[model samples]
Target chain A: MKKEWPLWEVFIRSQHGLAHKHVGSLHASDAEMAINHARDVYTRRNEGVSIWVVRSADVVASSPDEKAPLFEPANSKVYRHPTFFPMPEEIKHI
Target chain B: MSNDTVQYLLRLGDNALILSHRLSEWCGKGPALEEDMALANTALDLLGQARLWLSYAGELEDAGRDEDALAYRRNDRQFCNLLLVERPNGSYADTMVRQFFFDAWHHLALQGLCRSADERIAGIAAKAIKEVEYHLRRSSDLVVRLGDGTAQSQKMMQRAVDELWTYTGEMFESDGVDEQAVVAGIGFDPVALREPWLSYVREVLSEATLRIPPADAFMQKGGKQGRHTEALSYLLGEMQYLQRAYPGAQW
Candidate 1:
């Protein structure tokens, strides 16, 4: 049987001030190969200024069973929305 | 002088065109999806460079030909690309080895041309060097990985290096056209690219744990002079088919 390469999750920073956003996944033998694979697979259209890759196996995620216990309480917290805060018209970009 | 410059540009353009065709062969057939994309990207870059060069060649020739006419109408006997680029892409290892060798020379050649006395030549080289630099890096990285990889991979890479080494000599073989271009300050001497090419190849091979073939081994020549192996005829036949049948066909 042909052994398959490990899966890597890719992230891209589209510009200097932008945060790295999860893009996609690919298979590679190592981190360097992962980075190269990410560049080829995800950034072909001038979509990124920087790239980061992590082994998919290393990522942890909350299970669907934990969704209600972890997030249901926050749904009713209207104060978290900050809807009452007034915005200054002078602050354009914000 | 203009004729010599035109010929020099054809040499440059044909190298890119033929190699671009060779690499595009791997477009849907790469060992992996990522590799497929990478090879295709490199092929596109070379094709763009070819258009620039062949377009300039046609302009300098002052003939009715355009870039498409020059590219699709030329016979194999008229092509002046180095013999190395036309060699068959046998295996993945073979393709990578061929790519590594060509990319190294291309990077050096473009670097030299960046200082060309002709503004147009220098401009083309400047735009091309960035893509060629990335090509060199990727191919070099693969060479090391495959060469120092598993026993089977190491053996395959070694075989590829040995097989392709002889063809590399044609890249540095200077001739009358090159001489005229150099004298006219429109092109650099191919002979000057040899030392740096060898040093870089040697360093990379050593790191890859692959043996460097002896520098003085009997070398093949004549591709730049338009005497090519049978491989080029087959390549040109396929590459020119659409134009040959349709005659000025366009999308």
Candidate 2:
């Protein structure tokens, strides 16, 4: 039987002071190989100065079956919205 | 401006150009998608370096030739690249092994050239060394992994090393051009690169669990002086086809 390499999620930080954003995924035999693959796959066009790779299996996600219980009830709470608060002109930056 | 300097630059340029073309052959045929992109990137880097060296060679020759003219117009016999780079890419192991040997020598050569007496040569070397350093790193890392890999990979890598070992000697074969370059302080003696190249290669092969070939083994030569294996002609046939078919054709 043929074995496939593990899938790794790739993240790229385009420049300094910016967060690493998810770019794509690739298959690699190890973490080192994963980083190299990420560089070749996601950052070929001078897209990033830094790269991060994590195993796809390691990422945790909320289940679609639990969507309502996960937080749908919050949709009915209109007060949770911040639209009622007005921003002052003095706080321009915000 | 000297004839010998032009010859020296052509040797450097041809080596990069030929190897870059060989790597480009792997573009859509790499063992993996990531490997394909990496090989293409490496090829592009070498092609860029080839343009720098060839353009300088053309300018020094003052023959009205530019980088494109030199690249597309030259026949195989006019090319002065090492024979190792002209050999066919047999397999993934063969390609990586050839790359590993060449990158090791290339890194050392460029480092010496960075301090060349000629400011232009030094400047080109300074820019090229960064890309070559990364190339050496990637090739060396792959060599280690593949060499120390499963039994099948180990066998294939070892076979590649032995087969390609004979071709490596041409890289350090000093000739009249080399002697003149050394005397003029424009380039270092090719012989001076051998020791450092060997030491680094030895260390890497050791870490990779591969045996080093005999240093004084029967070696091949003549590629530096326009002689090459049959492989180069076929390579040139395809590479120079369009240019030969339609002179001065451009996109």
Q: Judged by lDDT, which candidate is best? A: 1
* Tens-digit lDDT string for candidate 2 (B15-124): 99999999999989999888999999999999999999999999999999999999999988899999999999999999999999999999989988998999999999
lDDT of each: 0.94, 0.93
* lDDT at B95, model 2: 99
Q: How many angstroms is residue A52 displaced in model 1 relative to the true structure, after the best TM-score fit?
A: 0.9
TM-score of chain B of each: 0.99, 0.98
For model 1, residues A17-44, the per-residue Cα lDDT tens digits are 9899999899999999998888878988
lDDT of 1 by residue, B119-148 (tens): 999999999999999899899999999999
What are the runs in model 2 whose C-alpha is more than 4 Å off? A87-94
The recovered share of true contacts, given per candidate in order, is 0.57, 0.57
Predicted structure 2: clash tally: 0
Best by DockQ: 1
Q: After superposition, how far is residue B212 of candidate 2 from its true place, in Å?
A: 1.2
